[model samples]
Target: MSSFSIRLYKDSDYEVVRGLFARGNLEHSHMAFRHAISVTRNWLFTLVMFLIPLCVTGSVILSILAVVIALSIIWICSRYVYSYYVDQCLSDDMLNIQKYYLQRDGYGFWVAESGGEVVGAVAAVPSSYSSEDKHTELKRLTVARSHRGKGIAKALCRTVIEFARNRGSDAVVLQTSLPQVDAWKLYEKMGFRKTLIIRESSLRYRIVDFVHFRYQYDLLANKLL
Candidate 1:
């Protein structure tokens, strides 16, 4: 079994934490690609491309090439969707972790360390959509691939929950994407209930069938303290 300790984030762990988050998010790209191809809309689009070539040239080879090109475009678009999110994150709060998380009250970041190496990370901050900041949003929650499935993620989540509860949050909430199947499961296992789902009409989300899920763990309704 892998052993690790969770603690508040520090300046020195910045690069490792950022890298972990990038890698973890990028790992879902393949899922995004598959989802894109599986969507009926994309399938119809690809089929139309294939049929157009076949009807014009009556050549199986050219038709197959058109199908390949369509699929390749979908693949590239899916990857770009994930890459764009990573870039946005790297340029946003992640660009200044200390300012965004450490310096603020009712906001915190934590990392899990094993053998002097940071293996997991999570954060909690006030939910912007909440009325009067009643909800705390769980953020990050990434574990290195090598150290996953050893209770690291669950531990990180518990840390966030404790932090939110201590800060007088009514509930801890989080947002995750459809590509992250494991993430939604982990949230459910930690007593979080799905509160909302959104289907974004933006190009990136449409390319990956990107559906957003919001989950909430009620600190008052449950005995998580």
Candidate 2:
């Protein structure tokens, strides 16, 4: 890293950061997680081979149990660590998702910052994802888990709605997992209705006992929205 003094972000820096957030969160992260699991399994196999010769049948059973516990711990810890990186990447990409979803529409982004770093981000497109006529799409809305429950999401969602409203959008649309009860409430408070045409896997069917919903906010018709 360069020793250059800290300075405000430039356009080039923002692009670099955006690219880093995209590639980092998605392709690289999944690949790295897979590689880590593979490598850890190989190492576990090697260690098991080394320890097998020194153990009796009962000892072997106990040793296997211990290894299973240790491996489970390692897996959980690794997943937690991965979530840190994933949050950063997802937050960054959420900003771009506004652009990607909007396509031709202007990408308006709302961010919450802390200590000179972004802690939350939300983005929106001027068009709806629903088959229904005339609705805006809330593209990617993400906040670091540490930064939740502080009205950050409310601000972000509201900002996008206003921006889309200005762009002549009639409604705001989105998809979210059922596990996020808080998010559902936020949408409801913002006048977003639970729609039925959502195409995401988690929404269309139970993805491992998970429930999902397609949410929409009518910009013109609903006063609460």
Candidate 3:
């Protein structure tokens, strides 16, 4: 089994953490692209476009154009969604860690290290969307692909939860998209229950947020364990 240690984020760990976040998000985007291609509706649409043009005019160019257009749309939408997450990370968390997390009360940032290398990261921050003072948001949970399956992610998550519990937080909440299926499973295993599903109406987010689930773990209820 691979062993690692989790600790509060240090200034020197910034670059490694940022790279892990970017790499993990890109992996999810690739998975989402494959899932989109496999969807029945998309397959049906492609079939219709290819057949209709061939039946009406017997033109190979139209058939090729149909496939190209379908793929182009998917590619463009996926790139836009990926870029949005990257921008959010740079603008919000990675840019000013001290202001966004360290200096604030009831907020924390952590990283996992193995063999003197940063391999994973997680953060807990005050939730602006929640009305309750005791609620904290878990953000930016990620593990390097090569180091995954060795409990690094679970360790990082527990570190954040313990921090929240120590800070007198009543609950911890997080939002994740469908593409992150493994993360969803991990949160559920860690005693987080689905609180809501948010469907974005904006054109740019619609493709990515077809189903975004919000999960919450009650620190008070599971404190003894």
Q: After superposition, how far is residue 91 of candidate 1 from its true place, in Å?
A: 1.0
Best of the two (1, 3) by lDDT: 1
For candidate 3, the lDDT comes to: 0.83
Model 1 Cα RMSD, 1 decimal: 1.4
TM-score of 1: 0.95
lDDT of 3 by residue, 167-203 (tens): 8889989999877899999999989999998877876
- lDDT string, candidate 2, 100-167, tens digits: 43354455555555555555556665454556555667754655555567676777787777777787
Best-fitting candidate, measured by TM-score?
1
In candidate 3, where is summed lDDT lowest over 10 consecutive residues?
Answer: 202-211
Residue 62 of model 1 has an lDDT of: 94
Clashing pairs in 1: none
RMSD of each: 1.4, 9.9, 1.8
TM-scores for all candidates?
Answer: 0.95, 0.53, 0.92
Off by over 4 Å in 1: none
lDDT tens readout by residue for model 1, 1-225: 887999999999999999999999998888889888999999999999889989999998999999999898888877887788899998998999999999998889999999999999999889975685779999988999999889999999999888877788889989998889999998898789998999989886786688889898999998743
